[model samples]
Target: MAALMLQGTGSDVGKSVLVAGLCRAFANRGLSVRPFKPQNMSNNAAVTADGGEIGRAQATQAIACRVEPSVDMNPVLLKPQGDRTSQLIVRGRVRGTLAAARWREGRAGLLVDVLDSFERLSAGCDLVVVEGAGSPAEINLRDGDIANMGFARAADIPVILVGDIDRGGVIASLVGTRAVIDPADAAMIHGFLINKFRGDPALFDDGYRAIEARSGWRGYGVVPWLADAGRLPSEDAVILERSAMSTGRRVTIACPITPRIANFDDLDPLRLEPGVSLLMIPPGTAIPDVDMIILAGSKATIPDLAFVRAEGWDIDIRAHHRRGKPVLGLCGGYQMLGRSIADPHGIEGPAGTVEGLGLLDIDTILTATKTLERVEGIAGGARFAGYEMHMGETHGAGLAQPVGHRADGSPEGAISADGLVAGSYVHGLLALAEQRAVWLARIGVDAVGPDHGASIDAALDAIAATLERHLDLDAMLALAQRAGHAATNG
Candidate 1:
């Protein structure tokens, strides 16, 4: 099989985006190309056509490759829950939960499943560009690591290391990684690409020469940071970047940063609204005086609550509530708006009870059983489909009710007594344009949220166009084919 792997110097070094770009670039050259990640750790996941959940980055790459996203693309996914434990997903389905130590010991066998899927995809595609996870030189994790050099070595794939210059230490990161990686893993790397560079490329001439000499690798090129990357919906929640909301009658929802945030993409639909803004406020940033405040989804409710307290955002939220402005929360965010959140089992943090923002007069108890479901319902006279994945049961007085019903007409979630403040287990309800317009109209704005699926498709198309502008994708595919041929001969 013809396969090429993109390894990184470190995590968040723009490897995911580059793989997506390369997938698009290769597909544009009339070659069937697929994107693969042997393993992924992300809370931001997308529901596939097969009713499975996988990392959003692979889904985005699937879109770029103009192929249907499947479980095979991301064979193993790790969603961090709390403590040292993570929810393990195999082939886009929840396998079970595992602590870090146990997971590391068990991961080698899981790679067999990953390679089976990769082989299936390779059989059909002309080329497959696999994206590696984290840094290859994570020594402690290397033995069982299936996402980096291990996967590449197993598949006998040639690797291209990507370094993020914008993060600083581009030289050290590249040199250090090459120096520390196992001989076999290091040998797999055929070249290096410098990414996210700003200012003149000419200025980095000396640095590029230095990196090539020290690392003994070919310098493919130095790519400038693409400012228009905001046009795409990011799959990683931690890299949230604030953009200006379009001027008009807009309701800006301020999301206070939480440590273990999940599904932050819940607000992405609002981003498409011409007159609606979704502002993510990090700690220490003053809550902008805005139309509404939205507490976003979180994985660790109690610890995030503590973070809210530490940042003094608790006071800002209370003040917003007193002003009678509408406030909304989803899942863990919902738990935080309640009067109290109990975690006796310490599923999220130190065993204790904590007071919530108290905006909803509700009480929440973190439980061992997690609810994971996808369904459609009416919200404020609009139809929408969303999913609920959480480990908490919420109950309270003056709680709002869900707008619609399931097949049995059972109440699924809650809303406020005044119908202004609300909370729900559902994520992605706002992605429905009609529902978003109804909410915006209440805030005195005649805005219509764009169709989210269409926006994603457009973004993918745009990504393909951008990558086509740069990169010698045809040559890359030729290189992969040649490498595969060489491996077969050896």
Candidate 2:
């Protein structure tokens, strides 16, 4: 099998989108393509068909390849629970928490498993598109790096360095990466691609060539800003800062942007509605007047609850609830809506119990075990398929008014007596058109949005077509083929 890795000059440089677009582009050519990322750091995760969890981006890429997502696509996932510590997931299961001081060492030991997953993933594939984490220019952490150049060198995969011209300093970022990284690591990069170019591609030809001339890498092509990229599920939380306000929408739904927000894409479908406006309320801003408020998933329930209170959003939510506005919570957000959340074992942080927003009568006890599964359920009389990924079990009288039921008829989620407040552990429910329509009707608006899943597939195809035009697909295929030949002969 042939493999090519895309490493960026820095984070949010469009490496994930590029890998995904290429996966679709190659798969469109009738190649058996698979997506692989040796390691990933993101709280935005997706449950796979094998009952495991991986980065959401890998799952999207799997969709791009028209394949089921598997844990082997991303063997090592680091879900940050806080600024200094992260929950480490290996092969789709949580291993333990990794501290900042031990991050380099902790990840170094996973190279064996990472490579093992890579081997298994590429075995039956014509091409495996690999995505590197962060940047190779982070030489200080390069000693035990398994996310970028280190993985490329060890796996003998060819690397294509990608630079974001929209971020400015593209010439310096690309050439400086080669200048700072170890010479051995630099040799792994076979070429360079400029991404997110706003204006005409020819306008940046001199600058693009300057990077190749300075770094001794060939130029693949310059890709203009892809409007369809916004339609795909984004893995980075930084994109939340760029959430634009939709004007003249009939209904508005607001979600507070918590520091440890996980699976924020749960609201992406709502953003697509022409009659709906999804507002992501950032920190220090009070929740504005809206038809509904959604408490999104959180990586650290206790800490994020504190953040909600600290930002005075708790006050805003209660006030909104008093006004008879609807409120919904998912996963950790559901935990935060409970009467209390106990973490005696310190699974998230210090061992203690914290009072919740008291929106629901249920109580939650954070446990060591995590639930990771893809499920189908009925909510609001609408059948929906989603996944559950959480660490707490919630129970209370509020559950008597369940929001839905599982396929086996087990009650799931809770609703308030007034039916204005609801919470569930299921993520991606909005992606189902029926479920989304039900929620829209609850907010007094008719759903006019297209099928969310179908829209995503169409967006992937559009992106593949765009990449085919801007990128040198034949050259890229030849490069990957050469790597395959080396792997076989070596």
Candidate 3:
């Protein structure tokens, strides 16, 4: 199989988005394409069709390729849980937790599993586009690295280094990478590309050439800043820091950005609504008076609940609830809205009980077993489809008034006596137009937004078109073909 890998000069350098675009661009040519990430560290995850979880970006890429997401797409997922520890997932299922001390050796041992997934995925695809995590320039981490040059060498795939020109120092970043990496590793990078270039591409002609001359690698193309990318789901939490509140919308919805936030993309659909203004309230800032407050998913419910109280967001939420404004919680947020949370197995931390925000008449207990599945159900008299990926269980009088019903006729989530507070384990409910419309009506905005799934498809097409225009597709195809031949022959 023909394969090309995209490695970035640093994190958030647009490697994921570029790979997704290339996947779509190649798929448009009627070629079978697949996306592969040997390892990824993210909290925003998607439940795959195989009943497992992977980073959300891979799921988006699968959609771009017009395929269902599989655990093979992202074989190794590291979900950070604070205190220098991460929940390690191998081939979709949780293996255990990896601490900072064991990070190197722990990941090194997973190379076999990663390659197995790669080989399996390659068997069914004509071309595979691989995305590297972080940079190869960190020589200290090069010892047991499986996410960059190590994987590239193991798979014998050609690489194209990407630099974010929008962040400046593009010339230095690309050249600097070549300057620091091992000679054998450097040889794998056949070319480089400038990403997120603002303004006219012509203005950076000299800088682009300078990188080529200094790094001794050919230039692929200079990609302009993509406006459509904002319409897609983001994998990194760093974006939350840079997120700004949208203005001029009729209804304001506030979401407090908690530490270890996971699957916060639940708010993405609301952002599309013309009448809804979604504001991500960062720490040290007070939660503003908004029509609704949504407590998003969290990786560590107990710790994040502490963070919420420490940041005085708990006070803000209470005041908002007293004002009769709606408050919704999803997954961990749902657990946090209960009366108390018990952790007997130290699943998240030291195995203790903690008081919740008490917005609803419910109590929760963290469990080792995790639920991962796609589901469809009825909520607010509208049919909705989404997935459930969460741990623990909640029960109380609130269960009598569920926010919705699962297709199996079981209660799905909790609703307050006053009907102003609700919590659900299901994510992506608002992505459906009917469900979004129902939520919008609660805030007195009767407008229905565009179909979110269709909008995402259109955004993917727009990005593919942009890449087709700005990137050298023929050259990339040639590189991938050459690498494929070499891998097969060896």
For each candidate, give its TM-score against the true structure.
0.85, 0.99, 0.99
What's the number of clashes in each of the models?
4, 0, 0
What is the C-alpha lDDT profile of model 3 across 366-404, one tens digit per residue?
999989999889999998889998889888999999988
Candidate 2: tens digits of C-alpha lDDT, residues 437-459: 99899888988777678888999
Candidate 2 regions exceeding 4 Å error are none
- Candidate 3: segments with Cα more than 4 A from true spot: none
* Candidate number with the higher TM-score (1 or 3): 3
Candidate 1's residue-wise lDDT over 50-107, tens digit each? Answer: 7677788898788878998888999999998667788898987878889998998999
Which regions in candidate 1 have their CA more than 4 angstroms from the true location? 101-106, 199-214, 241-251, 274-277, 284-288, 306-315, 338-370, 392-400, 405-412, 485-490
